[model samples]
Target chain A: MHVLIIGAAGMVGRKLLDRIAHEDGVLGGEVTRLTLVDVVEPTAPGPLDAITRSLALDLSDAGAAAQLIAERPDIIFHLAAIVSGEAEADFEKGYRVNLDGTRALFDAIRAEGLKEPYRPRVIFASSVAVFGAPFPEKIGDEFFTTPLTSYGTQKAIAELLLADYSRRGIFDGIGIRLPTICVRPGKPNKAASGFFSNILREPLAGQEAVLPVEEDVLHWFASPRSAAGFFVHAATLDLEKVGLRRNLTMPGLSATVRDEIAALERVAGAKAVRLIRREPDETIRRIVAGWPRDFDARRAAELGFKAETRFDDIIRAHIEDELGGKI
Target chain B: MHVLIIGAAGMVGRKLLDRIAHEDGVLGGEVTRLTLVDVVEPTAPGPLDAITRSLALDLSDAGAAAQLIAERPDIIFHLAAIVSGEAEADFEKGYRVNLDGTRALFDAIRAEGLKEPYRPRVIFASSVAVFGAPFPEKIGDEFFTTPLTSYGTQKAIAELLLADYSRRGIFDGIGIRLPTICVRPGKPNKAASGFFSNILREPLAGQEAVLPVEEDVLHWFASPRSAAGFFVHAATLDLEKVGLRRNLTMPGLSATVRDEIAALERVAGAKAVRLIRREPDETIRRIVAGWPRDFDARRAAELGFKAETRFDDIIRAHIEDELGGKI
Candidate 1:
């Protein structure tokens, strides 16, 4: 089977690629050819480099999606998007990349199918941001999407299109609404939610990281490994069981900042825990407060998708995946 | 205040125009100008003809929305759409008119705002088709939208755009999710749901009409007058009370075919009810089975948007509005 990965240069995309390369039978079939697409050309993993083709393309540009869809890959993973802050700051750019870009790709697939019979499996990376503030105690599978940001609105719209197209047999699509990836690898970022990862990742690396919110502050999270696993499972799952609602919120661990500190103390000792310095920024705190703290992600869980049940397990997974199992 | 009606030729649109002409203070302001647009030119009401300009313009056509926005109408009523059956049959035309056309109008508004500070009250005519089958006893305000048809998908996507644009202050928009308009003033059409109106309408007009589904088959409904009232209320209501969730399912009466027949018997006597013929179309029955049966439209009700509470009142509305107040 041939596979296509859009946004292959991004963090989650790279993780997915690594999993497909390193794990045998994870995709339920042999991936004979791999096409990696991004605004910046992506590099393939060493194991899959021989069969991989990388291309730099912007989906929103006229005819770009058509060029990609012409190959008719069996499974397509669309993970590209403009982040929340950037999308909110620049409305036009945000809509162009997030909304129009995604629609272009979907439309191209439909146009390709009109020539002959062709229906490929489409996996979309959605986010918890599809939901907004004043949420219930635990947002259920049936809860509405009232996005507080433009990025979230774009994601929600794409999910609707995916479901509609899939129902029409244009493509077999599934949207995985991922939780915030905790201990996100790389340098400190300016995103308000970045502090969730920074406090844990930096401290584990023997570096000081500022704590932006109270220890009691809670949020939802999953490891990068779980994120990749979600795409793999969605690719092979029996879509008939999913029915008309193609979008599913993936299972995630809901924990507080104090829980993270406790887990850090258990895994890497108090030295790493003490590396987290108290410096509350009211703006970040206020922004974080409006985010969803928990969800009854029953549908995803019932479909055999799994996530770390404890914060300790989440930290361990991060340490094993990013720290080479030596943290 | 200048008002623009995008689908001034459609049933609810014409009713809105009639209301504006007859009811004083209905819009809470003097209408300085009225612009009527449709795929075909719309006729202006006699009372408002001097201030009205009728145009034959298709919103999906390039530059049409921009030209309309250039005028900067104070209140814009967007009621145009490719109805459900047609949208289902022709996919490209559906997306072009329903999705792209709506976006074009919204973008045009934002572009006009960039040149000069201009914001308008945008009242969009959405539909309850946004929800699909296997609903709860009564779908509440926060239920997720899982559209079953292409038309519903387009409406849902437009609703998302409306909310995002409204949040950005590009336009003060509100989406009124209209229930199936019973006692719809029109000839017997081929639409699956047309029987909902035909059964009562034809019988009241001293003509025969077929009843396709079983007597126990229940559905949500409001009158044509209520639909116009919903748009009018949306235009003048304090949107601050609506908060971030701009779309609302308008209140409607939930009744069964038996209830409708009984109401008809009461309103126009058993002789008129005798004009009803039973045909039990299996295709239509199966189709109607997948539709939403009821809703908890508390939010729209609380916002002062009123609808007939009883099926009798709906029949009475048709008579009072369409039959010269005589049975």
Candidate 2:
């Protein structure tokens, strides 16, 4: 089956691409054609059994969404978004890209469907940011979305559109609200949440990283490997069983900084743990405080979407995938 | 104070206009200039203490929002919307009028803010339809909005935008999620929820009305006068106390159909109650079944928004307001 991946250049997107390219297929179907899309031209993988097409496209631009939908791939993975920090900083650009861009894509698919009978499996990569402050200890599937940031608000709106459009039979849609991908395989950026990954990723790479918040502060997480698995599972899941609500919170390990340190020590010894400097930044601490600490992702867990419950497993997965098993 | 009414031609809007005209002012200030807008020309009320301007302008049309915002009224009442049944029938029109129109007005206000420190009080007319099926015994203030219908989805999205904009300080906005206005005056339309008002309204008007659902069917409601009061209170309330969340579910009476009938009998006698014809409609029953039966509107009540709790008071209100005391 033909598959389209928007924002195919991001870390999770690349991982998803790798999974499809290496696994030979997904959802019990061979990836006969791969369409990779991003604002910048995404690097296409090596020639596989399937045909490969890569395109540089900005969804916010007029007619861009229609052009993208014109291809009509059987399965479309929309992961494109302006990051939280960026969206918050640039209000106009954030709403333009995140809200309008996403809506344009949905409208385009509807326009396409009007021309002929076509129902594609549309898998949207949503975020846990949809829930804001004053959250319950374990946010249930039924909890309402009240995003604190513009980026979160945009995602919430997009999720609403996905559910509505899916209900209308415009497309078979499923929105996966992914937890933060622990040990993001890259250099630490300026994001406040960057410290979560930096402390772990840098220590594993034998580098120093600042521990921004208290060790006991808990947050939800999943490995990069598991993030890819969610999109793959979403494309194949029996949505009829999902009933009217299409969006779901994916299962993830709810761990604290101390847990991460303990896991690091277990996997890479105290030497790696020593690399984490206890430097508290009140700004980051305050920002993180409002974030959801954990969720009752029972629906996702029951629906074949899996995640590492133990932070040790998360660390091991990171080492195995990013460091080639040499920590 | 300059007051701008976007849907000045609507039932609630006309009531609001009447309220302001008769009150001689609103929010403790004299209504110096009143600008009324709707798709069709709204009839200017008879001479009031304030100057009135009624214009026919569709908010979804290009430049219409900016032009409306250009006037920059001190308090803007946005009550315009396509009803639920119509929104369900015409998808494009719904999005265009409900979603895009609302956004355009907001963007225009934001643009106005950019030019100068112009922040208008934007009071949006949202609906309880924002909350969909599988509700709690009484939906609380914290309950998330997951509207089952396209109309509900649009209102929910608009509520998000309202909060975000209010938080950003671009516009001081408030969204009042009014309950089903019981005893809606005038003719009964083909809406599934029409019976909620019809059984009480038509019988009081000495006209027979059909009862589509069982007597045990419970629902939430507020009077047209109370809906108007909510907007007025929203305009003048200390929004800083509202915090970041600007949307609120107004307090209303939650009663079963039997409660309505008994109240009708109490006010208009059994002879008036007998004007109701029993004709069960499965389609409407299924639709009404998904509606919210009750709400814990504690927050709104705390904020000084009031509504009738007894179904008898509701009937008396309709009779006193619509039929004069003689009825």
Candidate 3:
């Protein structure tokens, strides 16, 4: 089987590619032909290099999506998107890239099918940002999407298009709404939610990190491995079971900052816990307050999608995956 | 206030125009100018003819929405859409008109604002079709939209865009998700859901009407008068109170075919009810089974949007509005 990964240079995309390579390029079938797409050309893993082709392409450009669809890969993973902060700051660019880009891709698929019988399995990367402020204590799978930001609105619109296109038999589609990836492996950024990962990742790297919210502040999380796993699972799942509602919220650990600290201390000793410096920024606190703290993602869980139930397991996964199991 | 009605030739649009004309052209403020637009030219009421301008235009045509926005009508009532059955039958036409046309109008407004500050009060006519089957006993305001048809998907997407644009302050927009208009003032048509109105309408007009689904089949409805009133109210309401969730499911009476028949008997004599013929249609029954039956529209009710509580009142509305005062 041939597999196409859009936004393959991104973190989750890279992780998904790694998983496929480690498993001998089998995602339900042997992925003999691999196509990686991003705004910049992506590099393939050593094992899969010979069979891989990388392209630098922008989906928003006219005819870009049709060019990609012309190849007709059996499975398509669409992970391309303008980040939340960027989308919110630049409205035109956000809509052009996030909303218009996704729609173009779907329309291109339909156009391709019209020429011949072609229905690829499409796995879309959605975000929990689709759920905005004033959420229920635990947001259920059936809760409404009233996004507070432009980025979230774009994602919600794309999810709707995915369902409609899928129902029309243009493609077999599934949208996986991922929780925030905790202990994101990279240098700290200025995003309001960055502290959730910075405090843990930095401390594990023997560096000090700032804690910007109260210890009791809660949020949902999954490890990077689990994020990649969601896309892989969605690609292979029998979508007839999903019916008309193609989008599913993936299960994740719902924990507080206090719980995260406790887990850090348990895994890396008190020294790592002491590395977290208290410096609460009111703006970040206010922004974080509006985010969803928990979710009842029962539908995805019932469909055999798995996640770490314990904060300790999440921390351990980060260590094993990013820290080479030596944290 | 300069008011513009995009689909001025439709039933609810005509009702709204009648209401405005009856009240001497005042919707929250004195209406100094009126602009009516439709695919074909709309005739203005005698009372407002001097102040009204009618135009024939299709919103999906290039530059059509921009031309409408160029006028900068203070209150814009967007009621244009391809009806459900037509939209479902033609996928491309549905998206082009229902989705692209709506977006073009919105983007046109934003572009106008960029050139010069012009923020119009946009009251969009959305539909309850946004909700699909397997609903709760009564779908609440927070229930997610998982539409089972292309038309519904387009409406849901338009609603999302409405909310996001309002959030950005490009325009003050409100999407009213109207229930199926019952006792719809027109000749009987072959729409799957047409029987909901035909049974009541044709019988009252001294003609026989076929009853498709079973008597126990329940559905949500509002009178054409109430539908017009909902748009007028949305045009004037303080959106600050509504916050960022700009879309609302309007209040409606949820009744069964038995309830409608009972009401017909009450309003008109049993002789009028006797004009109904029973011919069950399996295809219509299957189609109607997937529609939303009831809604807990408390939020809309609390927001001062009112609909009849009794089916008798609904029939009376049809009599008073469509027929002479004396039935």
Candidate number with greatest DockQ: 3
* Local accuracy of candidate 2 as per-residue lDDT tens digits, B1-327: 888899999999988887887775566688888888998988756865348888898999999999988988899999999999999899999999999999999999999889988999999999999988889999998887878999999999999998888888989999999999988999998888889899988988789999999999999999998998999899899999888878999999999999999988988899999999999999999998999999999999999999998988888888888888667
Please state every model's RMSD to the true fold in angstroms. 0.8, 1.3, 0.9
Q: Per-residue CA lDDT of candidate 3, range B1-327, in tens?
A: 899999999998999999898985347988989999999999888989999999999999999999989989999999999999989899999999999999999999999999999999999999999998889999999999999899999999999999999999999999999999998989999889899999999988899999988999999999998998998888879998898999999999999999999999999989989999999889999999999999999889999999999999999988888898666
User: What are the per-model DockQ values?
Assistant: 0.91, 0.74, 0.92
lDDT of 3 at A286: 92
Give per-model TM-scores.
0.99, 0.98, 0.99
Give lDDT: candidate 1, residue A127: 97
Candidate 3's displacement at residue A267, Å, is 0.3
Worst 10 residues of 2 chain A by lDDT: A43-52
For residues B115-168, could you state the per-residue lDDT of candidate 1 as single tens digits? 999999999999999999889999999999999999999999999999999999
List clashing residue pairs in candidate 2: none
What lDDT does the true structure give each of the candidates?
A: 0.94, 0.90, 0.93
**Candidate 2 segments whose C-alpha is farther than 4 A from its true place:** A47-50, B47-50
Tell me what fraction of the real C-alpha contacts between chains A and B each candidate also makes: 0.84, 0.61, 0.87
Error of 3 at B241 (Å): 1.2
True contacts kept of 2: 0.61
Collision count for each candidate, in order:
0, 0, 0
Model 1, residue pairs in steric clash: none
